[model samples]
Target chain A: MVRPAMSKEGQRPDPESDADHRAFANAAWSIPSYLLSGMAVYGGLGWLLDRWLGTSALLPIGVVVGLALALYLVYHRYGR
Target chain B: MSARQLLAAEGGNEFQAPGTEIFEWGPLWHGAPSWLTKPTLIVALSVIIVCGFFWAAFSKPKLVPRGVQNVGEVGYLFVRDQLARPLIGKDGDKWMPFLMSTFFFILVMNLMGVVPVMQLPAPSHIAFAIVPAAVVYVLMIFLSIKEQGLVGYFRNMMFPPGLPAWLYVILSPIELLSNIILRPFTHAVRLFANMFAGHLIIAFFATVAYWFLFEKLTPLGASLGLLGFVMTIIMTAFEIFVQALQAFIFTLLAASYIGGALHPDH
Candidate 1:
């Protein structure tokens, strides 16, 4: 395996750290899509339910709940 | 007659801000195909320019780079190091041809918004943006299914490890929709929206400057016209930065998507 060059301090850069950094960026970029999808899915479901049940509040509730769930997903996946 | 002359002739007319109408280009000539509009022509020109540039740069390899080849190498190194290597890992070099072409093609197309004759970025048309993004999306799906079996790809995407099985019922739908549908949608929209908005804003400022300074020149409006003129210059400079940045971001995200598909565990 060809190793990366050493730092001035004579310490080799850890390859895993680079991969971790990339994973971090990827997670950050994907978070918005996840949040939007979460809202769309649950909100659509809630809107359907509201039409069937003749209620108007479920849509807002679904959106808020979906947003919270998406945040939780982000935290669970990326926050260690 | 030129737009300026037409507007100037209409004395005392109100300032008309450039609108979505500015983006609507008819065919280059009467009786021409509707699809043969300015943007389509610019896209074709951009393709030729990108191909011609690389051909000139690399047609004859030099032991030591000089002139266009030097510039080409710099571009290659920037994409490889900044985008491909960082995002796609060790396999980055292998995918250079695809990623490099994507980066340059987009950069050149986005830059057309600033070029004098071709003031329209091709990707602003949405269809241009969609085509490249769709290609990447299809490639991503193909790679994911090929590397990880079709079932494995979906399992890994929808049911990420470390999540409890019961929770998967709710969260899985989000993951599936995001990865399968929203990812490419957002990817294409990001580039299209940026280019569309940037070009519109610059046109708005330029129109303001032209309308006030020439057509409706008055003491009160003169200052505003000066302000518009200054803003036009500033925004054009900023638009150049934004164009390059959007191109970089589009490529970066493409690489990230490919990286995810190729190495799902990451």
Candidate 2:
């Protein structure tokens, strides 16, 4: 990903070289927070559903679904 | 606990763990001047230390770079090379003052924990962390608006290029939530939690040693106290590493946020 991006851009003191490193750092800091916010938002929704429906099933399912969504979101934005 | 039992056997008081009360500082004066809390004092001290150090080091610039100038240059270069330049690129040098002050201010604040009498890191308090994080957050927003127009900024942020049209509704909120909301929250919390927990652990072990050795002494409790003392020694070293790392991470994230704001395309 980085190599292609660098070569694609014309050489200007290799600012592109730094992009990948910066991106890696940005990903490191944001990824966990993304996972957490995803879980909290969707898991809260699931918990509300469990309370309304009078069943304990949806919470775990909601949390799992949220995790998957978050993972997808992360990969789409940064990993690729 | 085991030490407390031994102390009890030796007709001494039980060991007690330190509590949150340790963090609850009392007002320093009659009126207390509203803003004169321990954390606030530490924050002011940190600013002074950072400014004073740089002033001493760089006030009289020598072409040859001797003594304090050498140290100042090293710190300046480290921030510019490692953090600012990599992310901000062409105009990176222009932002050096903000980035340098931020990095050093945070580093000094975090180091206050290890400084003898001043045992608390100002950033351990949420407000201290929030002040810097909020400043960065506001700067990011202001810069984003300045760099990209209001409509354009939101458009660029909420809708990245190349995503399918149908996926916009599903994905845009996540992007908004992660960038606008969670970014600052995590930024503040990361610094606060590390410093808070580090201070708590050190206080805990120090209290243990205090309880076993000075308050309730016994043959068996002495060994326990020795263990606690040793653990305190080890944890202090570990806390220093965490302190510096958290400072670096905080600054790195600040630079990252500024970079994102300045150039949304990336």
Per-residue C-alpha lDDT of model 2 across residues B188-213, encoded as one tens digit per residue: 99999999999989988887887878
Tens-digit lDDT string for candidate 1 (B107-157): 999999999878889999999999999999999999999999999999989
Share of real contacts kept by model 1? 0.48
**Model 1 chain B: ten consecutive residues of lowest lDDT:** B1-10
Q: Encode model 2's per-residue lDDT on A1-80: one tens digit a residue.
A: 11233223422387667677667777787788778767776787899999999999888887787777778778877878
Which run of 10 residues does model 2 chain B get worst, by summed lDDT?
B1-10
Number of the top-ranking candidate, with TM-score as the measure:
1
DockQ by candidate, in order: 0.38, 0.27
Per-residue lDDT value at B159 in model 2: 82
For model 2, the docking class works out as acceptable
- Candidate 2, chain A: TM-score? 0.79
Clashing pairs in 1: none
